[model samples]
Target: MTPGALLDLTDATPDPARMRHERHARLVASMREDGVDALLLLGQANAGYATGVRVPACEQARALHRRPVALVTADGADPHLWTWYPDGAPAGLRADHVHPGLRLEFDADARALVSAVHDVCPTGAVAVDEWTMPLRAAFDHPVGDAGPTIGRAKLQKTADELACMRRAQRINEAAVADVKAMLAPGVRGTDLTARLLERAFALGATGNTVDPIWQVMPSSIASGPHTLTGDVIFPLCTTTEPFARGDVIWVDNGLQFAGYQSDFGHTWIVGGAPDATKRAQCARYRAVVDAVVDAMRPGVTARDLTRVARAVEDGRRTPWLAHFYLGHGAGTESAEAPLVGTDLGDAFDETVVLLPGMVLVLEPVIWDDGHSGFRAEDVVAVTETGAERLSSLDFSDYESTR
Candidate 1:
């Protein structure tokens, strides 16, 4: 498998200080465009994006309860980080904006956070990525949803972000491939899940790094009847149920690296090659995916992709196959803005136009009731000319010799 063209590691790894400054600048520009005077960031992804400090996953639970917030103004000034414990702040944090030693409850902390925002920008409307009752009562000015603006800011990938995502995707594909090789009639679903995690870690996957860290998401492994029907139910095969011959094993998983993610799925038929019916179904699914991939390019809107996907399904005489989303933007979170297809309705801001530096995952699925299902997902990075597939694993063959 050939790796896609990527920036060299030396070039891709930006100095942490400089990276944070760049991110802050971009976010401030977005705020100005959106008419936001200041931002109160609550989401972990947004906080990390604004500060370049990796917020530990363990802290997220506390954040949800206590609300760890970051305040940034529209002038690109250094953001102020507010949390319950400033003494335990992440490394290299500037003490100027770090507000530690605060109460965990909403009223006190919300007052402190609002006061901090006022310290920076006293008179304009304050937007927040997430809001609570306490925040609404404490702030005097208007509070708007900052999720869309922050999400759009994250849509375009920096060179470092793209490189890290590419590496994570390669490692993820390798680990999934290892688990697929163990797909035998007697292998338990839990066993495969365990092996996937083991392989991912054994290959240097991590959740801590300023450059290219990674963390594996919980895997969805299903086989036999589970793979034969609607919605591809997850955790069904995560039981001790053993695989049976002719059972279709479907695995959907992802790995997060340097705050970016690699999300996709692949299906393997146990024991031998699929029969004619299964082969035909797989072919049709492949055709649909290929069509979408071929159409991915700069200036194409999500709505346009939706239309293309619908036309393909219609032409195939299997319109029912268009059940789920065609694809979505892949980044810090596995699923982000500019969601492709799946009836977005009239949300103009949500239907994003494809741009260079946007990474997307094209996933299409085909299923037959009481029979089997097929799905193959690939990651592609949009470029000045077109898109380049970052995932190099060979998904062409679904048959396993186990």
Candidate 2:
């Protein structure tokens, strides 16, 4: 496998077994480095990443009681999982290593978890992604945060992981094409969502990560929803509100496959044509993304990217939402580490250094104020040489307007 390869979409499929094994190896290495004896991942994506386990998509409240729990030790054995879906576990793990689901929020289940954990590792620093009150009170071990260990391990993508992302994005884009074709003055936000989700499922999407966002942006911030930060409230919850001609709709969403999530974002003008003013805004948005990407490579900091993005923005409203970020890493989860141009300030961005294998979703926005705006997302993988585009969707709407 090529290390630090530029991520691209291909017809080649990855072996799920190999991907799980490699990913586990990386987690083990990070665990060893961090002196973590065991990892108890309660988060859905974290558990799925630790083991090749899949659960049907559900709301957070339902998932809490029913979530799969993964236990990995520094001993480098297959994951020991307490999962509701035993069939979802990989074949590499023995049946004994897979146990019935644990109701971790209750004291009874926490006791069982404590016993099971002690039975295996008995001693070492334990890392946990989440904790309940009962869990903390019952299993009194040296519990540390799993963020650092998980972060380091997930920071770099294995070749197989990149391949999964490419396939997922391909499905997302193809499905989105259908939505774009059907966009019109009479279409509601839900109409776009229904079309995209249906097409995605047909295209082999395993699940939907986020409720599809088809926000019809207002002509001005004052005309839109009230925001304490005064930043444009993008991705406002979808409603039955129908689209009107010239309405600028910004879409952002995630589709899942093999536990990896694909992020798709782009702005569309209702009725398929944009005025010259809106078209100019789209061009400016592209320039900012280009400048940031041109400056992207191994060793660059998020500060460097933000600086370039802002420079190209030429003193606009930050080229991104003040509440959100210019870009973020993508993996098993929709958004993860190394965030850029966030409210976290320059000091934080300085700490986020670009490295090979890191996948980024850069979303630069261009607002014309009284007349709506333009925005879209582009996925790129930082390689040994430079940033490679993982997303292939082009600025078709912008081009048509031009």
| Residue-pair clashes per candidate | 2, 0
Where does model 1 exceed 4 Å of error?
1-18, 58-63, 66-68, 83-93, 101-104, 208-237, 317-323, 346-351, 399-402
Best by lDDT: 2
lDDT of each structure? Answer: 0.67, 0.86
State in Å the error of residue 146, model 2.
1.0
Model 2, backbone clash pairs (residues 3+ apart or across chains), number: 0
Among all windows of 10 consecutive residues in model 1, the one with the lowest summed lDDT is: 209-218
Screening candidate 2 with a backbone cut-off below 3 angstroms (N, C-alpha, C), the clashing residue pairs are none
Instruction: Report how far off residue 342 is in candidate 1 (Å).
Output: 1.7
lDDT of 2 by residue, 1-402 (tens): 122223334642568989999999999999999999999898888999998898988988888889999999999998888888877877877788888998888999998898877777787788898887788888775688998898899999888888888888888888887778888898898988889888888878889989999998998999998999997887788899889987888999999878888999988888857788877888898888888889999999999999999888765678888888999999988999979989899999999999999999998888878988888999998989998887876676567734
Residue 1's lDDT in candidate 2: 13
